[model samples]
Target: MIPVLFLSTVLIWGTTWLAIALQAGPVPVLVSVFYRFALAGILFLFILAVTGRLRLPKREHQVWLVAQALCLFSLNFICFYHAVHYIPSGLESLIFSLSTIFNALNARIFYGERISGKVILASLLGISGLVLLFGRDILDADASGTLTGVGLAMLGTLFFSLGNMVSRRNSREGISPVFANAWAMSYGAIVLMLLIILTGTPLIAPPDATYLGALLYLAAIGSIVGFSTYLILVARIGSARAAYATVLFPIIALGLSTVFEGYVWHWTGFVGLGLALLGNIVIFAPSRRPRRTAPIAKDAETVASS
Candidate 1:
């Protein structure tokens, strides 16, 4: 079950980058984001209703749900869509991969979870690998634009990490991930709609098949299926471990970029990919410790003898 969820998340989210790239023209980016969650929210609600699985969150859960929506579904994507305008899709993905580190840090701060030395080492290796992969782009690109994109990507990653914390809290509260996600997505869509109205970004749909197709794919597979599985992983595993999916998915996204976006692969990029994958292994490698057994009491042993 764990392997299935992990691999499915990597494959689904990895491909979603190309779909997001296809979402680039005509329609407002914010509006496109709005449309995605709105449609996904509707679908999730309908399915839950039909299955009799929809749940109403308690008052306390409602607040966290709203915060989760803003962080995960709203501001994070808003930053990401804008960030990708200035960076290649692969670079954008590499930056987003930092979520593993962010998740560890945020989990420690919010949940008081101890960070293992291996996790920290893994994060360092991952960061170094990303630097190797995109170091040339950072040096060669327009300074202001590159900085803006990197900053936005980092900000988006932070929000994503914060959302994971909220998801952890929701899990502790015994809320089903699917139920929480449906409400969070609905709230996120509502927030985006209000933003569109306020910004006066015309809610016009693009006529191109590419854009519409990408939107549907993102809404159905990416937003609904991908997020549901991911949050479920968060519930089953720790958020820090679950977020390793981001670390792994970028490799797939980079591969797609090579095919579709003419991303030239350097030798260093291959080395970097290997190191990043190695980091994932290090982070998830199980710790070895002998299980302690309870010592039998003398009285209990004597009773058994009698």
Candidate 2:
């Protein structure tokens, strides 16, 4: 089951980057993202309504839900899309993968979760590998603008971590993850729409079939279906385990790059990919022994009485 979900996410996400690469012209990256989610949100809501699954979340859940939408659905894409303008997508993806470390840290800080030594060591190894893989890109003078773009991707990851926590909080209250996500996407779309209108960004008529095709793919497959699968995995396994998929998806992205963009991986990139994969494995591996459960001693008096 895990493998199925992981592979599905990897394939969908892997190919989606191609669609993103096709986006051209002065259409602000944010506007492109706005269109993706707004259209996706509407379609998702329509599906939900048709299936008798749509409804408003409680007022108390609204703020965090909206925050999740902004973080996961909106600004995250804005950051990544705009970042691609300056950075090689491969290098950008390497930076984006740091979300694993950020997620672990955030969980520890906010939830009092213990950070295991294995997890820390694995994360360090993976990061080091990524640095090696993209070291040239990182050091190149031509990549200066991309340095800031990488920073934005990191910020996007932080927002995504926040969104994860928000979703967890919602689930703890007995709201279904799917329900929360649907609402979050809706709110995210609304926020993006408002931003678009306020900025007076010209929504040019569909430029061509290529743009329309890309937009539809992003809206349906990327936003709605990909997210829905992720949420389901989160519910089925656990958040941290589900997040391990993040480890695999980037490799898939790299594979796609190689096939379509003529990406030629050096030895360093291979080493980096290996290290990152090992880190993911170590992070998600089950403990040697379940944390020992203390046995409850039976009272002699109670036994005698019985």
- In order of appearance, the predictions have TM-scores of 0.92, 0.87
Whose lDDT is greatest here? 1
Tens digit of per-residue lDDT, candidate 1, span 229-276: 999999998888898888888778778878988889899998888888
What local lDDT does model 2 show for residue 183? 79
The clash numbers for all candidates, in the given order, read 0, 0
Q: lDDT of candidate 1?
A: 0.88
Worst 10 residues of 1 by lDDT: 290-299
Q: What is the C-alpha RMSD of each candidate to the true structure, in Å?
A: 3.2, 4.0
TM-score of 2: 0.87
* Candidate 1 accuracy as TM-score: 0.92
Candidate 1 local lDDT, residue 68: 95
| Location of the lowest summed lDDT over 10 successive residues in candidate 2 | 291-300
**Candidate 2 per-residue C-alpha lDDT over 214-239 given as tens digits, one digit per residue, 9 for 90 to 100:** 99998899878777777666666545
